[model samples]
Target chain A: MFKDIADVRGKLGQQQYIASEEIGTVVYLAHSLCKPILAEGPAGVGKTELAKAWALSTGMPLIRLQCYEGLDESKALYEWEYAKQMLYTQLLRDTLRNVLGDVNSLAEAASRLAQEEDVFFSENFLLPRPLLTALTSDEPVVLLIDEIDRADVEFEAFLLEVLSDFQVSVPELGTIHAKHQPMVLLTSNNTRELSEALKRRCLYLHIDYPSQDAELEIVRLKVPDLKPALAQQAVAVVHQLRNMDLRKMPSISETLDWARALVALNASSIDEKTLTNTLTVLLKYETDVQKARRMMGGGDDGGRHGRYNR
Target chain B: MDNRVVEFIRGLRAAGVRVSLAESVDAMHAVESLGITNKEVFRSSLRATLVKEHDDFAAFEELFPLYFGSGGPPLQSAMDDMSPEEQEMMQMALSALSGRMQQLLDWLSSGEGPSKEELEEMARRAGVEWANSPQEGRWVTRRMLQQMGFAQLEEQMQQLYEKLQEMGMSQEAIEKLMGVVEANREALAEQVAQRVGQQIAEQRANRPEDLHGSDLMHKPLQSLTEEDANQLRKEVQRLVMQMRSRAALRRKRGNKGKFDPKSTIRANLRNGGVPIELKFKKKKLKPSLVLICDVSTSMRAVAEFMLRLTYELQDQVARARSFAFNSDMQEISVTLSGRRAADAVTQVLYDIPPGSYATDLGNSLNTFSKKFMDAVDGRTTVVILGDGRNNHNSPRIDLMKDLQRRAKRLVWFNPEPQRQWGTGDSDMLEYYPVCDSVSVVRNLAQLATAVDRLLTER
Candidate 1:
């Protein structure tokens, strides 16, 4: 999928995804070794985005499976398409009667029906979910399993087989291995500890919040219309806010959104009045807004205006 | 497998990073595929194969350099570059040294002190640098032994001592020289190890990322920075989620609570009156909780975190009443439940006025019992968070026992260490027996574990 680490880095950069060298190296290795990459990090650090960017860079279709509580094989791997199976049974009722026309005894009829059961349980009735689709696709895909930690432990354990061997076993059809060997990426928010068996099957990568310089670069790329100085100042303010004892620090995406919000307002720089007016764009919790307001020396309109004028 | 890679894997295992046999084999293949020419690629490849969890990344990073660092200073022959005058002076000093010491020095300079190859192997395994020459190699061996600590050295030193005594040294003379030999060995070892460390560091110096995840779990809450606090918050949230699932699983396994005959019969009417699927009565009762927390300065840090836990777990309990107190008690359940967890904690801190800087548990209990006596019932579980310190005042032990009698269970969580429970002004010793359970919660992990136990028990 990638010639080398530099190639991976360059391609990701072209897709507007700034990856660290560690990330590029891991991606390169995962591609060469045909192993899945398990990306763990706090929310909004671009764990899912990395997979999306990889898809865009490689021109491969992206298959995503968003995990949640009680997620199971039927939802993630494959299902039988029960409604389709029912319709098929109804449609095939006449054909079944014709095929069994010569049968007289009940045991003979049952034996004939059993022999024809494979038709109903075959691929025609299989509804391929993300995992199966990724495996059975004609072209390699970028398979993203987002927030996998939210899934139940049993579901995670079930995933271990498919991830390690790139194959899924169906009771009726036996095991079906991958044809294209898709590039798989699993992301976790660390909501729960993932099982060791599942984690050992993949390459581990952790994505943390970007540093100041990196965040500035991201802001410039994401909100190209914003002034350089204004973007720099906004990132600086966000950094300061993160250091504060707030409920939720502004993530990188929030920083970009705040920069865009400032640009839309035609704000030249991060003044206290402007920041106070638009703090909600960055901080979701009211408590954080109040804390930021206090840290900026209160929400007094006159004080903020006087300081900005000077 | 590359010996260095195997050694690196051993180091990783020692640092608590698990590497299974399969993973080690895969890591070897990955290294071969990626090639070791590029340090970044090799490191990432090995890491991707060996490290399974996010937290283990730090251990991998720390161990990588110690194992794969470029060869240390080139090996040199002993006395090859030394001037004749220096060599003569060294020999003269060796002659003046004790016979046992001289023999040991000869063993060292002749490249036979405890086997240089074995010492080098030990150094490589321990991630220490081996000296280049025989003379320096002796110092490296001694340094490595010292680094292994006195207990380990003592065992090896005993064998060496026995060997020296067999070489015809007097008991008194041997005892006299033993202390000097040990002291000199330690000093030379320290100096040589420092120099070797500097040389390796100059070649390539990299420090792993700072402590995170489990490393921060047991640290004191008061010392936690914003980053550490955020990490702890995430961990606590994860624990709460896990506990919720565990409780749900337990409920499912114990689903034979009460037979719902009506529902069962209605459902089985289609199956010719054969009750194929059984249904059980669903319990409608929710657990009630009463949390009494100490908001004094000493307990405030952990108190806030505990309050956060209670807020997150409000759904698990039917009715949760939170009370914060220092010298006086005030119900803050409304504030805690009305807002986001972080906001609620901050708001509660702001809403409650700071009481006197002393913990008056007796007075607080008296206030709670007087005003909220009716709230305690057979279904309610009361949790008290404090150091059990009473400022040397009356503990009102009778009231505690009475409350325990009324409530289903009374659990106490003390942030102070267990050894300090009865010392100072703490009334823990007197009040401990009255409560159903007493847990010492000094950090987030213990706090989470205690809460998990509480949830599961219910």
Candidate 2:
């Protein structure tokens, strides 16, 4: 069941192969010991897809928590339904009045009001957020915390407490422990370095770009209708483009898009003509496209006539 | 499998392997799909997959075999086909050709060796801004020239010099071109050099630049420009080289004892000319260092240089271990394992993840004792460096005893200074204790004094 990352590597071309020895070893170790795997890499390098694939393989739903700059305890953990609390308060007023029947004192009324407030804000009124939901859910889940680097350092430190114990602490509810710990995955783009404390809690793996041959295989797999020659040509063009100092390098997804764009234009080959019209699929930024066009000796009019001008 | 190979190579490159895009494409078509998993297969696969540059092949071969761990009997069969003398000659030729080819490729990529029109076009691009002010134009031109990688630029300059000679250009013209190229090359190198030297200087100058935590705290803040930075770097390089040369010369000259009247009288009392006691002062300098580096992103490039400086000091300095800090601190002396200073620097900088926290100078001092003070003794001197912007983190003063108790002298190298110390979150005012000396370190010149102080202590 555990395919060696190298053996499986032989099945795909260099660029399309998603797993590395480092990544595979961590995956194998995570599965064996049931440790949470934390995959950190730059965006567009496929961190979320790996977790999704694992969930599919295990037949479990992938539970995602998209992290952002302002993610806080209430949003990530749990919060009470305030309207429900008010409705419950109204029902309790009528019931308690008949049951207790006038213990009429100002001090007693004040004390009762404070007691009711505590009851209203208790655990039963709380709504479970992704963390609590994943913990309490009946089925096994793959918990993915995407773009974790965007979150603040304090949040990372806070996450450490929950990640380490598979339990979270709430001021009103105390600690809610996980019945069965979900497979936790945290990804980052290395915007900032992670703390050693946070790193110690999970196995680490870094994902990077694919090689040309691997990329070629990926193109073939994703676009079977395209000619092998055209696919190879598009891969070659992408490879060349990667060498240039562009703002955003074409990703594997972009490579497929470029190929599809080439195919859709009814081009049998990736000649200079098709390249000019299809350059948009390869490069997103206007500045990047202009620079690439200049490099290829093309006109600003987006004409493909300049292919092989060099 | 073919597609998979391409993806895997790209992935490895993305992980910081420095694989070129062109090679990745070449590798894809070069190797047919194969189930080969052995070292030989993998090696061949990589060879098929990678575009081999001549000089790089040796390093590639070494790394390639090692990556797979015992890949078949090393493939030296290609060498076995020729006579020993012939093989040696061929190898030398290949090395030369490869080196030259790489140099040519680098020169071409750098926008040097462009056609005259292309050169004019590049100058015109700079000219657009030059229209506003001649000085700004010059600056733009210098920046454009600096945009090319230093290694690439230097190689291009060398090639240009060679071509000029081949064309029999006037000696004056050749020298002029060399000067321009050298100046431009120096500017590029200075960008990184000034950045590195500033930290060393800031530490020496005993000043840290203060920046309050606010929306207006511009980074690369009031820092040295690339040109000024390069000059400082050259100054540092020249100083070190001069020191090394002077030391060597001193050793060659042997002992030249100066006359001492007291010693002479004492010797005469003991029966002199006939027993004249000659006094000679020892010239050997004692060397010890304490490097405290800020590893925040703003200070990252500077931190790398300090790491390199640490590695360089390993052989020269008597006792040293470098520490890195952001919100926390870590001693990275263990990471400096290799021969090359740059290699050791990269290994440590890339491997050690700096934690997310503002500069906590006071806490870092407390941490030093727990992590490093035991290893230090009375002979060592301290060198503390930071922007002095403490970010209001807890300042633990009692722990400053590590510097007070163990160090022969504490040198707090503040990148900012007395003027900026108490302005913001900078707690430099609180760190006056336990410091035997403090300097405003902002350039290479300041580091010279710090180096001298460390050397003279012995």
TM-scores, all models, native as reference: 0.66, 0.43
Mind giving the per-residue lDDT tens digits that candidate 1 earns over B1-458?
49868767766665556689888988988888779998887887888789887666866775566567543322222344445654454455556555655655543333224344654455665444433223454555455555435334445446555654665545654454455445544444544454444334322323344666778888987788765776677677677767766865775565556999999888766555666668888776567888888877667767778777767666445487878888878888766653456767887777665555567878988998999888789989999888887888889999999999999999999888888888988889998999999998888788878988887686
| Whole-model lDDT, model 2 | 0.58
Q: Candidate 1 lDDT, tens digit per residue, A1-310?
A: 6888899999999999999998998898788778889998777888988999999999999999999976889899898766677667678889988989999999999999999999989999899999999999999999999999777776887888888888999999999999989899999986556776787788888788889999999999989999898888889988988776666778888888888888889998777789889999999999778767776755456456434322
Evaluated on CA atoms against the true complex, candidate 2 attains a DockQ of 0.01
How far is B199's C-alpha from truth in model 1 (Å)?
13
DockQ scores of all models, one per candidate: 0.36, 0.01
Docking model 1 quality class = acceptable
Worst 10 residues of 2 chain B by lDDT: B70-79
Stretches of candidate 2 off by over 4 Å are: A1-22, A110-119, A298-310, B1-439, B442-458
Q: What is the TM-score of chain A alone in each candidate?
A: 0.93, 0.84
lDDT of 1 at B29: 83
